[model samples]
Each structure stands twice: as structure tokens, then as C-alpha cells.
Target: MEFTAALREERLVAIVRGRDPEASFRTVMTLVEEGVPLVEVALSGADALDVIARARRELGTEAWLGAGAVLTAGDAQRARDAGANLLAAPALGPGVAESVRQGVPVLAGVSTAREVAAADRAGAAALTLLPGSVGGPAYLRALRAPFPDLPFVPVGRVDTERAGEYLRSGAMAVGVGAPLIGDAADGGDLGDLRKRAARFKAVCA
Candidate 1:
């Protein structure tokens, strides 16, 4: 399915970023097992590309694996080669164009009206509202007023309470990192991670 469609249906994107590559990969597998349909491995994490490649190898070609924090054309290219079906950036930059050119759907990040417009014009599959907590749900509602047709996925500082609020505010989906993954990616508790994932899924439901 298309990334936007997956977002609308799943209503959540599990972001995995950690200092340990093995632990990070394990965290991703745990999320996938929990039925978190969309997962993004931030490239800023250690050996993120290796994790993506390994996940792709294990999950096959059809999984909704994504590479996040993609900043340049090289990042985009490397991400695709690493088996990421999607690319997400913190802004409308070279990576966005490169991802589009490479036929990879990209979640271009935006925090203002102008950035939203610019990302939409750049052919992004969707817009990721970075630091979604800064303006809160009210900010997202305001943004939707002008760009009602564009898909917006709110990221950052999204916990269980805010997830539902963002969805009700018209977010196509929400990207959750530390709040969901917690220290699971840093060799925390998978059992606790499972419980947290269930809670998030319930909220998104």
C-alpha cells in the first residue's frame, strides 16, 4: 500500500533510534511483531543503515520500513539502497527531491505554513510536523485550515495522551519515538515495550 494510505489506516509510525545497533534492531523487530505497521529508523542512530538492511532482509521487500532524518541526496540514495521503502526528512531539502526522483515516497518535515506549502510543491507523499508539541494540536488544526488535502504526520513529543488528540485534530498519523520505544532500544525491557505498544495501539484505535 502507499505510505499515506498506510498512515491513515495504521495511525501510527514507530520511530526507533538508539546508541546500540543490535538493541535498536531488536527494538524494531519487537514493534513489528506488535503490529506497528509503519516503522522508521532514524539515520542519525548508530549503524541505522545496517539495521534497515537487516530488517528488510528479514521482513522481505514489502514491509513498510522507512529511513528518517534523511538530509541530503546521498542520504536518500543510501537509504533506498539499504531497502527503505520510504524516506523522511526534517525539512524540504535535497533528500526530498532525490527521494521523489528515485520513486521513493518521502515524508517531508514541516513546522510552518510556508514549509508545508514548499514540501507539498516538492511532491512529498506527506508532511511530518516536527516537534508536534511546540504548537500542540491547536497548531495542527490551524495548519489544516489552509491545506486540508495534504496529509500531515505529527512527530516528536507524542505520548499516549497526545496521540489521540493529534488524530482527532486531523493528523493522518503520529510518529512516536522515545515515548513509545522508551529505553527498549537501549537494552531496556521488551516486555514493557510490548505493553507500551499495546497502549499506543489502543489510543490510536
Candidate 2:
């Protein structure tokens, strides 16, 4: 499925960032096994590219694996080459354009109306609302008033409750990090992670 369609249909993006390469890769595999349709490995994480490559090799070409925190053209190129079918950035930058040029869907970050318009014009597949909890659902509703057609995936500090609120308020999806991931990426507990993932899927459903 297309990235945007997966976002809308799944309504959640699981973000994995860990200090251990092996742990991070396991965390990603856990999420995939639990049916989290979209997974993004932050490039800031240790050995993120290797994790992406390994996941791609294991999951094959059909899994919705993505690279997050992409900041430059080089980051975009490396991520694509590493087998990420999607790329996400904290803001609209060189990575967005490079991902577009590479024929990969990008989730461009935005906070203001102007930035939203700019990302849209740049051909971002979706707008990622950074620090999404700060403005809350009301802020998302306000942004949607003028750009109703744009796909927005609110990220940061989003819990199961807030995830539903954002979706109801017009966000196409919600990108969850620590809340959903917890310390699973850090080798905390896969059992707990599975429980949380199931809860998120239930809430989003």
C-alpha cells in the first residue's frame, strides 16, 4: 500500500530509537509482528541504517519501513539506499526534496501555517506536526480549517488517549515514540511493548 494510505488506514506510526543496535532491531521486529503497520527508525539512533537494512531484508519489500529525523540530502540518499521506503524529517529541509526526487514518500515536519504551505508546495507526502502535544487537538483543528486537504500526522508525546483525539480532530495519523515504545528499544520488555502496541491498535481502531 501507499505510505499515505497506510497512515490513514493504520492510524499509527511506531517510532523506534535506542542506544543498542541489536535491541533497536528487535524492537522494530516486535512492532512489525504485533501488526503496527508503519514503523520509523530515527536516524539519530545508533546504527539506524543497519537496522533499516536488516528489517528490509527480513520483512522484504512490502513492509512499511521508514527513516526518521532525516535532515539533509545526504541523509535522505543514505536512508533510501538503506532500504527505507519512506522518510520523515523534523522539518521541511533538503531531505524532503531529496526524498521526493528519489521517488520515496516523505513526511515533512511543520508547525506553522506558512511551513505547512511550504511543505505542501515541496510535494511532501504528509505533514508531520512536531511537538504535536503542545498545540493539542485544537491546534490541529485550526490548521485543518485552511488546509483541509493536507495529510497531517501529529508526532511527539502522544499517548493512546491523545492519539484518538488527534485522529478525531482531523489528523490523518499519529506518530508515537517513547509513549508507545517505552524502553523496549532499550531492551526493557517486549511483553510490555506487545501489550502497549495492542492497546494502541485497539484505540486507533
Candidate 3:
């Protein structure tokens, strides 16, 4: 499914932005193996696009692989070239709207009221709030107050357990990384996180 539409459909978006490419793959594959419908690979470094391609090939159509942490239109275009079906940015990066117009789903990140307004003006289908630690889901709820149609996805320093709270507090989706994927990501850890993914699913169940 398209990225924005998928968010609208209520599937959790698992973000894979680790300290390195290997960790990112192992972490994301964990969720893919567990039947996660979508995954995000933040374009944090040069190897990020390669990681997205590998994940797409490894998981095939079983999961939708995308890229995040984009800071420019060129980055978004590169993500698409690397097999990213969806594009995300730390904020409304330059040409973000055009990338989405080209068929890449855009989950543009926003941090403040002004940024949110900017993203809306840019036609972002969804917004990813960083440092979810600041206000977490509570702040997200407040952001959605006026723009009830807007989708706010909280990310950063969040764990599997907090996912339930994010959803309960009115977030459209949550982006989980280290807290759930962990620092020791590998096949074994993937197995464990898969179980945790089940727990996340149960919470929304």
C-alpha cells in the first residue's frame, strides 16, 4: 500500500535508524519477519540507501521498506533510487512535496507549531515528531487538537511499552528505534524484538 494510506489504515511504522547499517538491517528485518506491514530506514548516512535496498530485497513484498531522516529533495530521490517506496524527512525538507507527487509517500517530520504549519503547507500526508521524549504522546494529542485530520507520529527514545500509550494518547502512529530494536541487534535480538512486536500488536488489539 502507499505510505500515507498505510498510516491511515492504522498499521504501526517501525523505524530502523541505528548506529550503523548492519544494525539497521537486523533491526528492521526483525519486524518484517514478524509480519510488520511497513518499515522506515532513516537516510542517516551514505550506507542508509544500500540498507533500504537490502531490506526491500530480503523482505520482498511481505513488507514495505521506506527511508527517513531526509534533509533535501536529492535525498528523497536517492531513497527512491535505493528502493524506498516512501520518503520521510526530519522536517519539510526542500522539494518534499514534489517527491510525494512522484509517488513516494511523504511522512515529513515536524517539531513545532510553525513547523507543522509549514509541513501542512507543503502537503505532508503525515508528520513524524522527533525526541518523542519532550512531550511524548501528550504533546502529539495537543498538536492534533486543531488539525484533527493531521496524523502525528511520535518517534525517539521510545520503547515497546510506550507504544500503547502513544496510541491511547491519540498519536496516529509511533516510530520505535533503539528502545525496542536494542543496541545488540542480531538474529537473536531480532527474535526477541519480534516477540515484543507481538506485544505491541496486542496493546493495540
Report RMSD for candidate 1. Answer: 0.6
Q: How much is the lDDT of residue 148 in candidate 1?
A: 96
Tens-digit lDDT track of model 1 for 61-123: 899999999999999999999999989999988999999999999999999999999999899
Per-prediction TM-score: 0.99, 0.99, 0.86
| Candidate 2 vs. true structure, TM-score | 0.99
lDDT of each residue in 1-205, candidate 3, tens digit only: 5556677564477777666678677777777777666777877643788888888888775467878887777887788888887777776767486676676668787888888888888878788887778887778888888777778888887676777788887777787766656553433456667777787666645
Segments of candidate 1 deviating more than 4 angstroms? none
Model 3 is weakest, by summed lDDT over 10 consecutive residues, at 180-189
TM-score of 1: 0.99
**TM-score (C-alpha, index-matched) for candidate 3:** 0.86
